[model samples]
Target: MEYLLFRLYGPMASWGDPAVGSDRPTALRPSRSALLGLVAAALGIRREEQSLHDKLAASVTFAVKQYSAGVLLRDFHTAQVPSQDKKTIRRTRKDELQTGRLNTVLSIRDYRCEGLWVIAIELTEDAGWDIRQLKEALLKPKFTLYLGRKSCPLAAPLSPKIVTSDCLRSALDTEFEPILKDSDADRVWLPKSDRVTYYWQGRKEATNLTGVSSDKVWDDPVHRQRWQFSSRTEHSASKHREE
Candidate 1:
């Protein structure tokens, strides 16, 4: 019955993909994990806070509209790595902290430029943080809020507001317009029909993706000091202006 609306606009955004290696690919749209991470950071909740993450995941429902897919921009990077072992480290420490001689490694990160997505998060139950708390946190976040990566800072304010809607389509239709960038190539992917694609917890991707399905919560860092995700249900929705 209540939803929190916000906008994610950035010069460049890197919505992570399921890739697991040197080349960190990005998804076309923001992943469930990324959304949760944004909220946690805004609330100043540490990554080690597992219980908080679980509560947030279970208490709220998330949906995003891919207004602009943007163009893919690949960044070429050469970084130092441990000469000895360790699968890979996300951050490199000082030169002296290395356990062994540092080795130069090549890493590629993909990003989307001129991208914009409208996010609608609904409180499914009277659990976890309240919408008011979330709005306040976003306004004065303890930690810096980036689109998906720290390198890509948000280009605009979240401008979060509360709305009344039972479904994402109606919620969006009431406010959003399909604004595309100057470049037509960045047009968003469209379904066979003008339907908003939705992804909710435990929602299965039926023959039609418009349905909901269960998905992994990839942003959980507290369970173990590793990149892990627990199961959660999410929903998605989409519509084409031409239709």
Candidate 2:
């Protein structure tokens, strides 16, 4: 099997989870929707192009090797919101703040500090684009890409590569040079644990993976504009590196 591999490192990353009320939580690893959005942005696919987005979402699966989930960071934000009206659609934050009778809304946003992850992209039989095309897109993305939020910029290059491996696990195991030299390893924030975690979605037989656990997650993108997601099963495993 062929896979497109890439590295993502940033000072602040937020892999959003199912959010409710005033609290917005984040996952340890990147979500499926976030990965799809990253690739779509690289390809210059617009959010209004629902058909293309759906096609791309169905065309690929991902396996993430989480080297560092990073430490938890929270931000307290206060925004002005108009009266509750399901009929009202505010296009921008400015528009919302300008609306009649503004009310203060408090929100707590979560982020991971100096997170690092390696993503492996596996194509489906109905893939719209080949692995090489995806690699090229990442190399020269049409639109600027950020780790998660626009406020959180990438600290390093994606360093995308293509690897042909027998199984999904092997593809994820593919390595690249460290983002920083050995002397500068401690210059930035990184996890101290040698244990690596893997998260993927697919049949065990097809992926040739022995997952320690599996659970349903609601990160699968259904409609980007509407911010709708569907549930899918994700399998996970862990490995401790030997010195």
Candidate 3:
């Protein structure tokens, strides 16, 4: 099986909640839909294409790395209102104003410069898709696609190979070297290790400092560690479906 991992990062990123309306928006952690949309746009798929939706059901995950967290608001410029000509006013009474025209203005709110998040998309194809094809499609000069927000662009290259569980663990350890280790031969796990799921937000305790023993400090939940793991079960299923 093959996969595509993206290292998403930028000055600002806004991944909205699925329940938000067009006017009112709320930012949430990355979701499956947002990631799929990014992949679709990278592949240059049109909105009318059904294949993209069908192909997205395979196992996919989003690993968000929060370097900084903040919010931003923007104003809306364009809005329309009812005209007085040939328009019936909904309410006309002694207590109500007789004006037939009403003006309405709208504003847009969004998140501004925030931290970076790495989104790794795992794509499994049995027919054997080339990693270079995925890379070329992503790094194209005119490509304007993004995982969640326009400002948030991919960080690392798209690796089109299934990353093993051990490899994923090792990668995280390597990325966060001193934090995950106390000494050359002794590595200690945090107290909140069981909650070490994807997108775990936890505070870095004092023990998390360099040269400190893991037992010397308390474990505070601040931000969760985000990682992706794929196993043989998924590999076999993806192969059967493709065939």
Candidate 4:
């Protein structure tokens, strides 16, 4: 099978989490949701296009190999929320007349500094878009592509290429380097149904990073609506070389 390869590297990135609190968290690697979003943006698919989204998500499967996890950079930010025209404003006394009753909220956002990852996307025969189409769109995206946030832009070109591989493990190892040992390799999350069924393996590693992300991608294939996820298994395996 043919696999599309690309690399995601940036000075800073934020693969967001579903935490509703004073602080926003980020995942170590690119989440499945973000990957889907990247592709959708390339194809210029709006979030409201549920049918289109589901078709794409169901047709493509992805694998990621992280070269560097990067360091965490926490930032403190303050923002002022403007009062709505429909609501009566309570006058808070300030030194300047320009202070028209705004809510100043402080929030902490987490970022990954100097993060790097290699991505491989495989499409089925019934995929929404073919390999060439995907590569073209990515090279010339409909929208500006960012690592995970608008502020965190890409450090380098994606350099998307196509490779022949029997499975995800082979794709990663052939293009990149070897996974010396089990510990040296990161978990490659593969979407699944009842269970993960693939070839050439090792063991799953427990990590704080989770990939059952909240980024909604055509969650329902039938009706084409809502947020849903195909279960994934964090897989590690010995590296292989093509003959």
Candidate 5:
């Protein structure tokens, strides 16, 4: 088995936190969709091919490292007024665009700073190829990859190899723990668990992967929608290997 590991980092990455309405919520960590999209982009797939309407099968895993913690809140608003062209029964372009310009606002409810960290994305496959070759393929300077959202940027492609569950666990624990002093709050109040792990295995029905689900993926209503893809015969060899 070979896996491609990606290291995601950026000053400000939006992971779409769980929020309501059209207001987008940012993840405190990286996301599967963002990672999958990066892979698709690297493969030179078009936007239409990446749409949820198109099903693509690829497995992914996400490990979140929270070096900093801050509370987030969002708000939304919408209004419909009389159309400028009464006879046409259509709203003007300006009105439509500004209708909800400030529809959402985010504020950090709390503050905790950890500073630096790393999140590993393990993309596994049964392909009979060298992991080093895959890593080399990803290093193409023109290759543009994103984390969960367009705003999130991956730092670099890291070496990928078979990782033991224990090793993964230790890495998460060591880097995520905050050094609390006795003077700190009695409860120490660490950032909401600060560590998350995900594992995705390719499934037949959709282009999306299945396996370990994340609260960020499932609990968020906006992410509840699933993507669909037509399994074309062109990639039959890859498909067969995955199966």
Candidate 6:
């Protein structure tokens, strides 16, 4: 099987998880919806293009090799908004501010600092776009790409490459240039573990790694406009590395 491979390295990344109230949490790895959104942005697909988004979603699956989950960082934000009134119509921020009566809203956001992950994208049977086309789009994305949020801009190049492998694990094991220099790693506290983790979706046979566990995550995109997502089973495995 052929896969499109790339590296995502940034100072901060926010892989969104299920949100509750004003507190937003992040997952350890990038969600499927976030990966698809990255591809759609690279291909210049807009949010309003529902048909196109649906086709793309059905056309590909994802795998991830997590190098560093990064350190957890939390932020607090407070913003002022106009008081809610059903009778009043505020077209923009300017109009809302003009109301004079304002309310303060508080939100807590979470992030992963200095996170790194290698992503593997596999084309499905109904794939409309080939690996080469996707590679080129990623090389020169039509729209700017960010890790997960607009504030978390990428600190390194994606370094996309196409490789053929017998299984998903082999594709993910393909190496690229290191994100950080030896000196940088020594000076800064880069997140690392004795065991490396792998996550993938699709049939077990597709990913040859064994002794895996499964869990349901609600990251599957159903509709971008409506912000709807469906749950899907994800498989994971971990291996210990020699110190």
**lDDT of every predicted structure (CA atoms):** 0.69, 0.87, 0.40, 0.66, 0.40, 0.90
Query: What would the per-residue lDDT of candidate 3 be over residues 68-173, giving only the tens digit for each residue?
Result: 3344555466544554555454454431234545555565645544333334444454423355565566666234666466656654343323343333322322
Pairs in clash, predicted candidate 4 = 54-218
lDDT of 4: 0.66
Most accurate candidate by TM-score:
6
Each prediction's TM-score versus the true structure: 0.75, 0.91, 0.49, 0.68, 0.46, 0.93
Model 2 poorest 10 in a row by lDDT: 203-212
Residue by residue across 1-243, what tens digits does model 2's lDDT show?
788999998989999899989998999999998899899999999989999998998799998988889989999989877898888888988878777779888999999998889999999999999889999999999988987788878888999999998878778878788777888877765666688888988865444545478899999988998989999999888777551
Native-vs-model 1 lDDT? 0.69
| lDDT tens digits by residue: candidate 4, 27-130 | 77777677888888888888788778878877787777665657889999997765455554546544222546577789999998877777888887788788
Candidate 1 per-residue lDDT, tens place, 1-243, comes to: 777888788888998876667898887677777888898888887888777877777676677766676788999999876665466553647643556676788898999887777787777656678888988888899899998899999866787888887555566545543334557535654222233343444334321344344545454333523676554444454445553
For candidate 1, give the lDDT of residue 237: 43
Report the lDDT of model 4 for residue 43: 86
Candidate 5 has a TM-score of 0.46
Q: Residue 125 lDDT in model 2?
A: 97
Better of 4 and 5 by lDDT: 4
**Candidate 1: how large is its RMSD?**
5.6
Which candidate order results from sorting by lDDT in descending order?
A: 6, 2, 1, 4, 3, 5
Best by lDDT: 6
